[model samples]
Target: MKKTKKLFGALTLTLLLGLIVGCGSSGEDKNSADSSNKGTTDIQKIKDAGVIKVGVKEDVPNFGYMNPDTNKNEGMEPDIARLIAKELTGSEDNVEFVGVTAKTRGPLLDNGELDMVIATFTITDERKETYNFTTPYYKDEVGFLVRKADKLTDTASLDGKTIGVVQSATTKEAIEKQAKELGVSFKYQELGSYPELKTALTSKRIDAFSVDKSILTGYVDDSTEILKDGFSPQEYGIATKKANTELNDKLNKSIEQWEKDGTLEKIYKKWNLD
Candidate 1:
């Protein structure tokens, strides 16, 4: 009877030990997985993925626009993005261009959909809280594009008129502040995309379109002319996820090197921005 009791006790102890060991192994595996995931930075992940994903504009010509014939993104933004990719991965060909507008770029970067954004993204203190931005690679100013027949010679002429601006862009606020300071009042229509704003302007749904002067240059022709006065100066920067300081540092270094080597100036001149 004692032997039977001893055997039962041993079995119970063995089962308890097995359960403890199993739980410990599971915990270790979970910890390992967490550590593995946390060990890689954003740039490291891009390197491992073998391609850098870049968010760029598809409509803003000369900055980031798609070529209809080539069916590829071509512009200063794309050039800069490719240069970064080449610097990081040793090949500009190893880049994937993702189309993003002003409103979508922030959320896409935050969600890890883009490794970086080079889509004429302006650097501001508010945006600094959410993402890391590199040194300004380009500078621009806010201006208006109006039909020549309207005879709108300056920003003040747009008082009491409707203007179209891209949603989530800083142009509207800049214009509003400037207008208020100048004692002028005007209404603005927020469009979801730049093309929509262009359409609104052409259809006379809005008297003018307001945005960065560099962007407006692409849409201007004989019928449209940019206003002589600009409202705000904007600095464009490359943006990455907030936690990706390594990538930002590398990008800043690349920009510094490019500036020193005259590569930046060459690109600016190529785009007629110099």
Candidate 2:
């Protein structure tokens, strides 16, 4: 009978030891999975995926736009995006451009749909907290265009008038910021596409369209005039998920090289933006 009791005790002890070992292994696996889950940032994922997805506007001219004449996308920002992709992937052919709106660019980058966004994103401290931004690729001032026949002659003349701005634009934000500081709030409309916004201005649907003063020459004719005097300043930069710092640094170095080599200035002149 004592032998029987000893055998039962051994069996129970063995089962308890097996259970303890199983629990330890399960815990180790859980920890491993936790570490794996925390492992990859956006930059690593981009290198792994081997494709840089770019988000660009399809309608803003000079900066980002699609050409119907060629049935392809073309613009300064798109060209810059292609350059970044080529540098990263050893060929510019690997880029996938997703047309983005002002409201979509931030959330899209946050969600990993885009590797970087070169859609005329404005750099500000408020935005920098969540996303990494490259150095100023372009500097602009928010200004408006009015028909030569219109009585609106200057920035000071925009009081109580309705103005147009692309939604989520730095130009829009700067205008509003300056408006608040100057206590010169005007009625305004948020536009989705630059083409559509420019059309509205030409059709006299809005008193004026406000964007980079540099881009105004393309949209307005000799019958129109720009109110650039005392306009608010803003900077445009490429955007990426905040975790994409390494890739950001690489491209920043590339931009610095471009500046040093005068390649960027050449591009600016090619686009007639300089």
Cα RMSD to the true fold for all candidates: 1.9, 3.0
Q: Return the TM-score for each candidate structure.
A: 0.93, 0.86
Off by over 4 Å in 1: 1-8, 30-39
| Model 2 lDDT tens row, 2-51 | 99999999999999999999999999999999998678765567667788
Superposition error at 161 for model 2 (Å): 1.3
- Please count the clashing residue pairs in each candidate, in the order shown: 0, 0
What pairs collide in candidate 1?
none
Report the lDDT tens digits of candidate 1 across residue range 66-134. 999999988898999888878778899999999998999999998988999999999999999999999
lDDT on C-alpha atoms for all candidate structures = 0.91, 0.81
Q: How close is candidate 1 to the true structure, as a TM-score?
A: 0.93
Query: Where's the lowest-lDDT run of ten residues in candidate 1?
Result: 41-50
